[model samples]
Target chain A: MHELSLMEAVRDQALAAAHADGAIRITVISLRVGELAGVELEALRFAFPVAMAGTIAAGAELRIESEAAECHCTACDAPFPAPDGCCDCPRCGAISRQLLRGRDLRLLSLEVV
Target chain B: MCRDCACGEPAPDPAAVPASAPRELTLHTALLQRNDAGAAALRQRFAAAGVRAVNLLSSPGSGKTALLEALAQRLDPTRLAVIVGDLATDNDARRLQAAGVPAVQITTGQACHLEASMVAEGVHRLNHQGISLEQLELLVIENVGNLVCPGAYDLGESLRLVLLSTTEGEDKPLKYAPIFHGADLVLISKIDLAEAVGFDRAAAHAAIARVAPHAQVLEVSARSGAGLDALIEALGLALPAVR
Candidate 1:
């Protein structure tokens, strides 16, 4: 998957943040990945070590929080739990809806020391 | 919690992590923020130059090239150019070039989709080929043909056009809702094959309405040239023939 490139970027950000915080190294990098973010968690776990090699994030623990997909129907503004490609509104049966979450891929924090 | 040694210890649980519990720095930064930054820069570049850069997204065999070719024959030759992205060959770019449009190919190799950085490089490569981005009125980016992967990556276009051919089926918008959700325009291509394929136009429109209520739907056929003029008009392109 494209997790390697994304992890490489996470490593870079971790290093910069650690440097700015005056830490000798990064201990952990926490990330929030949504279900609809198109990232494979297993691939991201496999890519972490290689992506962080030779950097401040070398061997740094990667914590990934998987968020569930949720959406709201565009027609009647009905909220619904959208997972596994289920996007229709239960209330209005309207297909079009504004996606409220489940597309996130964020680095929540960096444990540095 | 060491930076180097892995001494038979289990990785910490990702779910039980508290916002400010164990981490030293509460960064709260989006992991793909760099991609967002890149996209923002590209958007600014296009805006500054007043370029109408459209990112065309579709599944393979959705007639993106055919539509672009139709546009090539219709739009101003001097002002229109293309940047084609594909996983392997530059066949689409070659086809566009053959249609008399300045086309640059960005072969993504193993990548599934084209990123903003790749678009930047494509523009640079086009500049090297004496096809300046500034001179062109339209810069069409033919994204690697996949509805799923390209949905997340923004190539920073003025418009995002998602194409669904009639043969593909009516459930496409429902199945790949995210792609349709982000599209500025939803083009129903290959409408000429509707009769042969039993393509239900009403159902397709209904599906699109469910997923992308804001997207303007246009039915076009590159083969019979039906709705090609309307397609050009949708892009707000002042065709040479009309001029």
Candidate 2:
């Protein structure tokens, strides 16, 4: 899975930030992973420690804030959460709903010593 | 010392101390920020070099190699060279080479998709093999044969070309809309076998248009050399002129 690479990136960023702040170790890494981001949380967790080896983030906790898939209904001009495998707007029952969010992957914060 | 030890003197046990003591370090960093930065650098490099890198995505046996061979035949050899990605084997590269252009293969061991880093590495490898991007008109990165994973990763390409063969059902685009949505062009390969395979070209085009309205659709057959000129013309228009 690409989660190894993603975790490597996370570890690199965390290490760089920790080094810049003169921190001895990283405590936690917080990330916002969207539903449609195509990242598997379990896979990410499985790969994190391996990727973090020898880095500041080694043995650090990974905190992921998962976001639900959301869409904007073109017919009703309303925003709603989309169910898995179905993008029909919950309000107007229209299938032509435009995706608004839930495809994001962002590193929000890191807790370090 | 025995008395102190027996009395349980307040001394930190060297064995009790963790080999690597856990420390309180707080760092705020986005997990993907590093890759994004690398990709941004690659984009700048491509732009500066006036190189338009196009990533080709498709399923296995979808004729990606054949299409590249056809493209090499049609394209000016002095201007084009291809970099192919595969899990193993240099078959695609060999085929492209047979067509008279330099080709390099990046064997991504067990990696389902080619990321920007792999592509950057591949670029270096190609350069070491005497294929310089400066003299190239187009750098076609034929991504590892898959539909789902490759759609999620951007290889610092200027454009993404998704190839769907006519033998596959028209509903493929609708089913794999993520790949279709990410594509700049949707090329329907194997048009020669359309009627034999009961492929409805119009319906297929319509499905693609539904998912990606902005993507240009091209129907081509590498076997018969039909509809390849249009693809070449499109490539000429999309790729920046190499000096």
> DockQ (Cα-based) per candidate?
0.38, 0.33
Chain A structural similarity (TM-score) per candidate? 0.88, 0.91
Which candidate number maximizes DockQ? 1
Q: Which whole-number lDDT from 0 to 100 does residue B113 have in model 1? A: 90
Candidates' C-alpha lDDT: 0.84, 0.77
Best by lDDT: 1
Clashes of each: 3, 11
Tell me the tens digit of each residue's lDDT in model 2 across B1-243. 235567566666756754454454444354556556767788888788787788899998999989988777666776777779899999988888888978889899999888778888878987898877888878888999887677777677888899999888787887766567667888999989999999988889777865554578999999998888788777764332452
- Residue-level lDDT for B223 in candidate 2: 97
State model 1's lDDT.
0.84
User: How does residue A82 of candidate 2 score in lDDT?
Assistant: 58
Q: Estimate each model's TM-score.
A: 0.84, 0.77
- State model 2's lDDT: 0.77
